[model samples]
Target: MTDDIDPDEELMLAAEYALGLLAPEEAAAFEQLMARDADFREEYEAWAENLADLTDDIAPVTPPPALLNQIRAAAFGTAAVAAPQPEEVEPPATAPVFETATAQGRGLLQRLGLLPAVGGGLLAALVALWVIDATIGPSLALPTATATLVSEDESLVVEIAYTDDGEWLEFNRRTGRAPEGQDLQLWLINGDRAPISLGVLPAAQTGQLRVPEDYRQLLHGGNCAISVEPLGGSPTGAPTGEVVAIAPIVWET
Candidate 1:
């Protein structure tokens, strides 16, 4: 609600509201905010319009009678009963002229391809582009690097990727678990350079390391290694246990 909120977070909140995913109390509060804030109202309207266009291509489906009856019974403690059909009524003779004019206008628009030009596909693409810009921003075009760390016998394998934020490592352990009393520590090693401790891997076998600016230069074209350490990690600055896996970092344009 404050102007200091992150723009991306604000946009996402607006999108969630437009999707009708907010609870009743939250929706009421958002509506009240929108009423007082013109910019917030505009953001909500844009999201609503884009979402409506994105889902417009989906066909409506009718639920089975049994399902409908069950829902009705749960809500009202009884199933709905059918009522007598209403008698058919005739329309005024002028209805044909209005119907013909409407058909003619639709035919003209079809001939001009205006209707198809505004179809769901284009709207979907626009929505995707908007989301990408909002979340990843323009920095998504930056280059990245990757590598695969493997043990001496090639039994243990871990995938590593480097981006602007930092390096990410993923292991494919059979159990994806660290030793009962030990932790797995990651290291970055360059020729003759002291092994730099990157951090310990999570029990889930996937973790990220934010390379400090001072150490970023040493990470490129370096060797990545993992070693088993004490529960809290290596007490000494250097690795004390045997190196488990090593891989060469490869940069990609």
Candidate 2:
């Protein structure tokens, strides 16, 4: 392969293939070469193995006390304490109103408290590539990956997290929603693969959706998107309307 193709260009193609940055036709051509050429196959695998190592360096961030309390409340159905009467003194601001949640949801929140909007896009893309190329083990008990999908016009922002063990995904709509007559549908995109419907997002600010068994593995380095569709959802099986928001699914920790 290097004899006909420039060695530098060959390596670059291998890296791009490993990252899933190539278009469908391009990826298909590359895969054909890999099937016929042992050297090219080794080169692509090397890049894939190196990319998967990125997950090892991720570290979780600790949220502020108040924010932690809110996460706990959302994870569990813990109600906020009632306000003090006018005649009575209020409790200290730092005091906890609800017991800390030790459930799986809380575990996911702890790792996902401070994900940046810009960071991890590449990591997520590369991780998706790694997932496609490598054999990943079973899902973890708690998910640490998350994505914040924002529209180009900044009209919408949705936070997404997936729990492979539970086979469910949690979404928190921080801002924006469908127009009065429309509903927002969620789609999961993995590399050059076709987008899979996660279904219409709930109107509620926070909710969970059960994921099908096959689609669970695709969430790690995939992307979640929200598109404006008809009242119930897309009439077509696929997205026929404009995609309003999109973001890469990434590790929070």
Candidate 3:
């Protein structure tokens, strides 16, 4: 199989397969070639590993509510499903625990939080092992640290994670939204220093924002606050409106 195709073409095909960008029929053919050619399989695996590195610091994002319907419509050529009214769940009246799942079974964002509501030391150890074995291997340091911000009334909840090496912060807004004509602005509060505006939170539930190299160091041991400001953000270059929620950054170490 390897002899019949040009070496460079085979390498390109391997990369396409690794990225899942090949058409179904072409992918099946590539898989068959991979099974029969040990060298080709190795190339494909290497490509897969290299491509995985590109997303190491990327946070997992929750899909939109209508994504399932769009997927169904695409694959089955069926009409979209009727939207169901979401069941209202009451917020916990007590202090926000910042966790809902067990350490081992949590999703990526929750696992990266290092189990803020649970035993932090144990979960941090477990997560370290998992990250090394599963993703970036041993070459990279633990990629990110996490924190959870909850409003005083627990009406708003957000999970924030930042990577020192990548100089980016990922946010997951678990609940709540900005009030009418207002926006949620994320700010970094480091000691007596004035708050540094990360940016206005997006309407989407989850997203990432780039951080300056100087600001990355401040994320650890510092605090984050979300303030309700005008549509764009605070006009004063600082938090000029009511701060809705604040939380301390929790590092994996």
Candidate 4:
């Protein structure tokens, strides 16, 4: 419905359909067309929002006939009596157009820091993070608290400090295990309160765990515990297998 569009193209389809200017046949064609085209769909998201938003701000004020006549004359030819065509704006520039189902696929790649390339070409994507970070300064450090780790049936306890950021823990692994898939996972328990995930562990003679930030709050409130978990970590966010070594991280200074 826009200028130079022939009252036919898909972009005009969305523009007119969005404005309630499309006939039933044209509206049906637009919906079916949207199912196959990603770029068109992206454009629709941008355009539809604008049309929908105007509903609340503007009221239904009927203008005088002279004003209405002038407006109609300006928009449509004098002989053509139909909805005035609204021009379309450029679509929102989003990541490559993929179905929402692909959102999870996109996230998986992002977790390993791989998504920047697919959206824009490699160089453009690589600069996105740097550009984004430039506008925002360094991450702020969280408040700190102290806790303790202790062994049962023995008196090996260590007091530790944790911050809202996270706690880094190191512990010894028994020597002499062949590489048959032995791995270490870390978990944080706040008494009856639900536990949150701290990531998987790296294997060395001694290993370090970055405990969750919430641990400080839990420990300060008197409910903190830790356990080594299965290789790929707990299947559920909550621990499932035996909790190996446990400690209450307590703050002192």
Best by TM-score: 2
Clashes of each: 0, 1, 0, 8
Across 1-253, the per-residue lDDT of candidate 3 in tens digits comes to 7668555887788888777676433543454465456687789779868987999899999887556555543333233344332332332245223222112222222222422222233234334434432322223356456767666466677788876677679999988899999999998765435778999999999999788888877675466778889999999998877776655565542
By TM-score: ranked, best first: 2, 3, 1, 4
Query: What is the TM-score of each predicted model, taking all chains together?
Result: 0.40, 0.46, 0.45, 0.31
For model 3, what is the error of residue 105's alpha carbon versus the real structure, in angstroms, after optimal superposition? 28
User: Which ranges of candidate 4 are over 4 A from the true structure?
Assistant: 1-180, 205-216, 222-228
Candidate 3 displacement at residue 59 in angstroms: 51
Q: State the lDDT of candidate 1 residue by residue for 30-103, as single tens digits.
A: 54355346677688779868887987898989765456544433333221334212232322233222211111
RMSD of 1: 25.1
Judging by TM-score, tell me the better candidate of 1 and 2: 2
RMSD of 4: 24.3
Order by lDDT, highest first:
3, 2, 1, 4
Error of 3 at 154 (Å): 1.4
Show the colliding residue pairs in model 4: 146-250, 146-251, 147-249, 147-250, 147-251, 148-248, 148-249, 148-250
- Return the lDDT, model 4, position 32: 34
lDDT of 4 by residue, 90-169 (tens): 32244222222111211111322321112122224224322332223223344344333332322223333455445564
Runs of candidate 1 with Cα error greater than 4 angstroms are 1-140, 165-176
Error of 1 at 200 (Å): 0.9
Tell me the lDDT of model 4 at 163.
Answer: 50
How far does residue 111 in candidate 4 sit from its true spot (Å)? 39
Query: Which candidate achieves the best lDDT against the true structure?
Result: 3
